[model samples]
Target chain A: METLFYIAAAVTLLATLRVITHVHAVHALLYLVVALIALSLIFYLLGAEFAAALEIIIYGGAIMVLFIFVVMLLGPLAVEQERTWLTPGAWVGPSILALVLLGEVGYLIVAGDLPAISIQEPRQKAVSIALFGPYIIGVELASMLLLPGLIGAYHLGRRLSSEAR
Target chain B: MSLQDLIVLTPILNLGIFCLVTMLAIAFRRNHARIAAFAFVACLLTLATLPWVASATPRAVTALLIVDRYALLYMGIVLCTTMMVIGLSYHYLHIQFRERDGIEEYYLLLLLATFGGLVLTVSVHFVSFFLGLELLGLSLCSLIGYVRTRRHPMEAAVKYLLLSISASAILLFGMALLYFESGSMTFRGVGMVVKQVQAVPGLWLGGVVLVFIGIALKLGLAPFHMWIPDVYQGAPAPITAYIATVSKGALVALLLRFVTDIGALELPSLVHLFSLLAVVSMVVGNVLALFQQNVKRLLAYSSIAHLGYLLVALLAGGPTAAEAVTFYVIVYCAMTLGSFGVVTAYSREAGDAEQFEDYRGLFWTRPWLAAMLALSLLSLAGIPVTAGFIGKFYAIAAGVDAGLWWLVLALIGNSVVSLYYYLRLVVTLFGDKPASATTPQGLAIESPQTSGWMAICSLGLVASIILIIGIYPEPLMELIRTSVSNLLMVAQQKP
Candidate 1:
């Protein structure tokens, strides 16, 4: 199980790197969907089955499709457009920094001083009770957060469509 | 959940419902004036409910929110400032937008932003804080770019959105780290860990510093202040006022709560870090302000310095810290809104009258607006006879009491350095009009429109408040003392 978790984590990291480095938006979206799926696999390995399912369903499936649609709507990019900005200088520094971070994290895990994850699969009933009980205000506040977000999106989108006309 | 909880939550509840109702009213019929009037009245009603909410006295409505005098005081300030913004936005939008354009949604976004600020003041849990911050941020993105046809506002909106998203990500990561260390999300839970522990972990300190960096970026402190000038310059005038005041003020309140809860001042490392941020922010903010040609950008830099001064009070953490911070925030909001309100009043159909050239001889042309702007600039400079002076005095006093000599000196020096540009603008207001200068398009000199009058009256109200507080600070100080006591009591009770 631990080996599988590592495998999933490696796949997720590779997919994320591809998503960041890919020149084309469509390819990036595909890689991002792959990363999300691998992330859900890691979640499942951690015993958060509900979160894993939700992650795949909401992020990997629904959001990926939306992203693809938006990219399609934006049309094809000029071939060298992003390449001009994505020179080696841009990625080299960040990649080296990321490598250092990865090494540090790997060292910490191998040191075996950190506590192991307690794998408790949260029941759907328990999740609902927690969400509706003490966290109910947060739920309500989240709704408020989405309300303006939707309005603002629709507002900006309407203006864009009108401008296109 | 319970009757008392609902009652304690009335101020937020009332505003939240009004936001929805206002949205519906716009959908039912998009009458700009009617909707603006409805939002203004809704905010007024929310302000009215605060006293009742206060009567419920220090109730934890949920694990997420704690309604106390500290939250209520900031809420009152937020609501009042929003009302002023709504009033100022009315004519500005009316003249800016065509009749076919939907201006009513601006009010909806404005009210939602206010609701977000209100939620932030009372948030005790990370969930509520993140939600509130996002709500405010998302709404602000649209509001900043409401003039979508213009390129600058759009660019400004995108800049603010990208930077703000990164900052929020850092904040979330910090919260996750802190939760990992303490196994808790509530402020009180973290406070308990801090209280019980003998030696603090490095992970916890890392989380705290990351969180402060995120918030300092939001507050536009020195090193993290790249976005302020562009965002401030590009946003519409009234919305600029909103960003400068309510958005940042709520964060200050939250920072105070978190710092006090953890007894962060007791740690020398944190004290040194804060003092460093304070001094750098003051010097950087003031120094940058010295060269700004645009009024909005100038105020933007001045605001950075002002926040740095506020950090001195925050660093001075003791019985007087919260009071000093609160008083300074109120004074900051009043002066900021007053100056931005003047900008809104004089803003033309083309764009905001942000250039120093636009204000040249403004006193000769428009005395009332000029006087208000002059007074606000004086306050921003911490000149005598304005609330900014008294606010600075309190901050200095708190710093002295805490023995933060260098931070206090930096603050005083920055205030002196800040006066050059502020007075430069004041001189521009009274300076000679150029012979070649054409009447800048739509200079608000045609006639006294009703909406314009309403905007001017609000500016007058802000100016009067500044003077009243400056001249008679005792009553305001008394109020702030009580509120700070309530805050300290709550912080103590948590552990």
Candidate 2:
């Protein structure tokens, strides 16, 4: 189990590194999908089936599709034309970030609660109850946090979209 | 939810429902004054009903929020400060910006931000804490950039947003680490677990420090203070005051609760770390302010020093320190709000009267406004009779009681140094009417509607409170003492 965990962790890191190394946004998005899938596998191995499936559906599938749309809408030529993006100057920063990420993962593997998986699995029902029970206030507050972002986004684009502008 | 839980949550819930209602009202008929009045009345009604909230003391609404006197007192401060900011903005937002179509949304955003402060005060758990902090940060991001056409405000908002978002991410990482180390999410649970472990792990200490860094970023302590002045200068005057008082005050209250909950004082080294932050923030904030010509930026830098003074009381760590922190929050809120209140009133026309020269000869033309600004500045300088003086003295007393001489001496030295800038501003206000009478722009000159009178009247109210608190602080002092004692009795007993 420990070996499998380490392999998944390494795979996730490698995929994310590949994502950054790519010049094309499309290629980066693909690498990101691989990284996220690896993460879901880790979650599944940890006995959080609900979380693993949610990760795949929301992040691996839905969010990736959205990113692809944005990249397409923005024109693939825009990124493809920037062939100079692979310069050594850019790699210096990303390499540093990659090193920091590696350190964090290594530390978590040693000290974090990444132990062997137990047999008993908590189902989605329990997750719903927990969300709706003592933690219900968090759900309500989270919506409030997003409200301003929603209102502010609409207001921001209004001036540009109007005929007056 | 139970009846008790619902009632205890009213302060937060009221603002949230009204935010929605105001949105609907705006959609149906976008009337600025009506929407503003609706939002204002909602805030006032929330304040009115706070007495009822006091009846259900120390009730934990589920596991996330605990409605107690300490939280209630801070909530009252946030709500009152928000009310004053709203009153000021009502006038400023209408006249200054010609494109007033969606400016009404600013009030909706204001109520939401206050709701954020309210959530923070009552939060006992990390989830609520982070959510509240984000709500406050996100709303301010929009509010700071409300006047979109202005290049400076846009720049300030983006800077504030990027830094704040990164800070929040770092804070979440710390929470994750702490959860891993202690195997619990609640503060009391973390304290119990950490205490039970005989030799505390290095990981635990790392988590604690990481958490502190994230908070210091929010507090705009020395290391993370680069954004303060620009954000202050760029934001509209009323929102700048909001950032100084309600926003900072909520975080301070949360930090106090977290410190006491986790029994960080038992670990003397952590106490020393806070003392170190106190000294650095005091010296750095004051020194930085000495060079600033813009009054808003000056106030921004000065607020950093003020927070450092409050930290002196916090480092003292007892009921006395808590009372000092509480009283000074009130004094700080009144003065910052009043000083910025003067700025907001004079900010009706072309540009805000921010630069020191802009305020030159202000006394000659607008004596009443000048006097209020002077009084607020004096209070900020810790001059003998104002609220700032008493707040500073009490904090020093708290440090003395704790025998923290080094920090005490630093506070004293910084206080003396800070007087130069505060007096400089006051002297500028009273300086020989600037050569050739460079006419100060805005409010008094324009025959603005009742909104002008409303904003000025609110400033007058804050000035009176400052005088009352300064001359006879007994009433406020007694209330703070009771609140601190009530909260600390639980705080010390838990660990």
Report the number of clashing residue pairs per model: 0, 0
lDDT of each: 0.86, 0.84
DockQ of 1: 0.45
**Chain B TM-score in candidate 2, rounded to 2 decimals?**
0.96
Q: Write the per-residue lDDT of candidate 1 for residues A70-109, one digit (tens) a residue.
A: 6456556733544554567545543553454355447546
- For every prediction, compared with the true complex, DockQ reads 0.45, 0.46
For B273-332, candidate 1 gives per-residue lDDT tens digits of: 988888888998889889999999999999989999999998988779899999999999
Q: Write the per-residue lDDT of candidate 2 for residues B1-495, one digit (tens) a residue.
A: 899889987877887888899989988988888988898898888887788888887777877888888888898899889888988888888776665668788888888888999998988888999999999999999888887766777888898899888889888998998898887778777777667877777777777888888999989988778888999999989999999999999999999888888878778768878888888999999999999999999999999999999999888887888898999899999999999999898875566768887777678878888899999999999998888899999999999999989999999999999999999999888877655433544323442323386798789889999999999999889878877786787665652
Interface RMSD list for the candidates: 2.4, 2.2
Task: Output candidate 2 Cα RMSD.
Answer: 5.2
Every model's TM-score = 0.91, 0.90
